[model samples]
Target: MICLNSLGKRIAYLRKRSNLTQRQLMNILDFENLSRYENDERKPNIDIIVKLSKHFKISTDWILTGQEHKSYRNFQHKIELDDNEKNFIKLFDQLTEFEKGQIIGRMEQLIEMH
Candidate 1:
C-alpha cells in the first residue's frame, strides 16, 4: 500500500520544483491550511489528489506510484517546463509591480512592431 506520508513528500517535492510555496500551491488547489498535508502531519483525500495532479499538470498515477527504477517520483518526465519557457515567472518574481507593468508594455510594443 502507498503511504499517505510518502505521497505528501512527493507533493511537496514537486511543488517546490514548480517554484511555488505551500501557500501559493494551496491557493491554486483551493485548499486552506494545507501545510499539514505537505508536512505529512495530515492525509489528503482523493479529491485533493485530483486537484493537485491537475494543478501540477502531472499524471495522478505517476505521482502516486513512482517509477520502479527511480528513487524519486520523476515529475520532469510527467511535466516539462523549460527555463526559457518559464523565464517570465522568474522575472515576475524578481521585478516590482511597476517594473512588471513596464516590461509588459515593452513586450506589447515589440509585439505590435513585429
Candidate 2:
C-alpha cells in the first residue's frame, strides 16, 4: 500500500542523496510544496510524482511504495552505455552549471528541430 508519510520520507531521501536543498529542487517543484510533501502534510499528484521520479532517475513505484516494479527492476540490468556515451557523461559532469545548462538547452533545441 502507498503511504503518504513513507512517500514523503522517500522524496526527502532522494533529495538528500543528491545533496539538493528544497530550494535547489525548486527547479522541479516549489520549496513550499516540497516542504509540505516532505512533512507529510500533503500528497503529490501523479504529474508531480512523475516529475520527481524523472528528476531522481528513479522508479515512481519505488518513490510511492518503496518497491521496484518487476519490469523496471529487470530494465535496470539492461542499461549498457557505450564508450562514447560514458565519456560524454564524464565530460558533462565536469562542466560548470552554466555550461551544462547551455548544453542542455542546445540539446533540447536540436531535439525540437528533428
Candidate 3:
C-alpha cells in the first residue's frame, strides 16, 4: 500500500521544487479538497493519481512510491509551456465537454486577437 503521508511530502517537495505554492498547486489540482491531500489527512483516488501523473509527466507508480525522477519539461514540439499554460492543460483535461468547448472558444478568441 502507498503511504499517503509520504506521498504528501513528495507532492510538497515537487511543488516547492517547481517554485509553486499550495494555493498555486490547487490551481492545477483544482480541488478545494486538495488541502487534505497536501496535509496528508486524505489520500487521492487513482483518477486523481493518473491526472497528476500526466500533469507532472511522471508515472503514477513513481508518484505513489515516492521515487525521485526527472521533472517534467514543459514542452511539446516547439511550444514551451509556461506555468499558467501547464496549469491550464492539467485543469482543462479534467473539465466537462461543455467546459472544454468554452475553453476552446476562448482559445480561438485569443488566437484571433494576435
Candidate 4:
C-alpha cells in the first residue's frame, strides 16, 4: 500500500485531484523530470520544489511531508491564473490601504474610459 509519506504518492495525488494528467503537468512545468519524481526514482531539488509549491499554491512542507496544512486542506476550486495575473494580484495585495484605493480608483477610471 502506498502511504502519504511517499513524495511520489503525494505528487500523484495532487495531480489527480487537480484533474491534470501527467502530460498536462509536464507541459505546464516544462520539465521532463516529472516522471521520475512521480515514480520516486528521484527527488526534486529545492528549486524544483519551490517551483512546484508555487505552481500548486501549496506549502513546501506539506509537499515534502504527508502533513495536511490548513492552507492546503482548505484549498478551493482550482482557478488557473497565469504568471502575469498571479504577479499582479500579489503586488496589488502588498499595497497600502491608500495605495490600493488609488489603484482601484485608477482602474475604475480606466474602466469608465473604455
Candidate 5:
C-alpha cells in the first residue's frame, strides 16, 4: 500500500527545495489543496500526480514509491521523443521565461478541470 504521510513529506520537500511557497505552487494546485496534500489529509489523483511530476521534473514512480523503476532507469537513455513532441519543444523554447510560465499555468488549469 502507498504511504500517504511519506508521500506528503516528499511533496513538501520538493516544494521547499525549489524555493516555492504553497501559494507559488498554485500553478499546479491551489494553496489550500497543496496544504492538504502536504498535511496528508488528501491524496492527489493520477492527473494531479502527473502534473506534479512534470512540474518537479521527476518520475511519478519517484513521487509515489520514492524510487525509480529499475527497468526505466536502464532503458531511459534509449527513449526518443516523437516528431510532434520535438516540434512542441521547439516552439516552447522560443517563448520568454514569463510566457513559458504562463503556458505551464494554463496547462495546469486545463488538467485540473478534468
Candidate 6:
C-alpha cells in the first residue's frame, strides 16, 4: 500500500541520496513528470517503477513501502546498517575523487587476494 506522500518523499530522498539531479533521472524531454513523482503530484506507472527498481537493484517493495528484503539487508549490514544500503552507497559515492581512488585501490587489492 503506497501512500502518495510517503512514496513521493521516498523517491525524492532516494534520488538526492543517490546524487542525481532530476534531469538525470529520466531521459524524457520534459522533466516535470519526474518532478511530479517526487513532489507527490503524480505516481510513476508500474513500468517506470520496474525500470527504476531494476536499474537501482533495489526491492520494489522497499521503493513502494520502505521495507527492504531481509536477506540482502542482513548480508550487507554486518558493519551495522543504521540507515539503509542505498544511503551507505550514496555516502560512498559522494566521496572526493582522490578518496574514491584510494578506496578502489584497496578494494582491488582485496579482490586480487580473494
Candidate 6 lDDT over 2-81, as tens digits, reads 34347777877777777888888775322358889888789888667765676667778777887877886887667655
Alpha-carbon runs more than 4 Å astray in model 2: 1-5, 28-32, 75-114
**Model-by-model lDDT, in order?**
0.74, 0.83, 0.73, 0.81, 0.81, 0.74
Candidate achieving the largest lDDT: 2
- Pairs in steric clash, model 3: none
Which wins on TM-score, candidate 3 or candidate 5?
A: 5
State which candidate has the highest TM-score: 5
> What lDDT score goes with residue 107 in model 3?
89
Model 6: CA > 4 A from native: 1-5, 28-32, 69-114
In the range 42-71, model 3's lDDT, one tens digit per residue, is 998876777677768777767788654444
Across 3-77, the per-residue lDDT of candidate 5 in tens digits comes to 434788888888888999888886655334888888888998776786688789899998887888999888988
Candidate 6, residue 97: lDDT: 55
- Residue 40, candidate 4: how far off, in angstroms? 0.6
Give all TM-scores, in the order shown: 0.51, 0.57, 0.51, 0.56, 0.64, 0.51
Models, CA RMSD each: 10.2, 6.8, 9.1, 10.5, 9.2, 9.9
User: lDDT at 10 for candidate 3?
Assistant: 66
Return whichever of 2 and 3 wins on lDDT. Answer: 2
Question: Relative to the unseen true structure, what is the C-alpha lDDT of residue 76 in candidate 6, on a scale of 0 to 100?
Answer: 67
Between candidates 2 and 5, the TM-score winner: 5
lDDT of 2 by residue, 23-73 (tens): 889765543588898888899887678778867888889889988888878
Task: Candidate 4: list runs displaced more than 4 Å.
Answer: 68-114
lDDT measured at residue 95 in model 4 versus the true structure, 0 to 100:
78
Q: How many residue pairs clash in each candidate at the backbone level?
A: 0, 0, 0, 0, 0, 0
Predicted candidate 4 versus true structure: per-residue lDDT over 12-59, tens digit per residue: 888887999988988987677787898999998876676677779887
Q: Which has the higher lDDT value, candidate number 1 or candidate number 2?
A: 2
Give the poorly placed runs of model 5, Cα more than 4 Å off.
Answer: 1-5, 28-32, 81-85, 88-114
Residue 37 C-alpha lDDT in model 4: 94
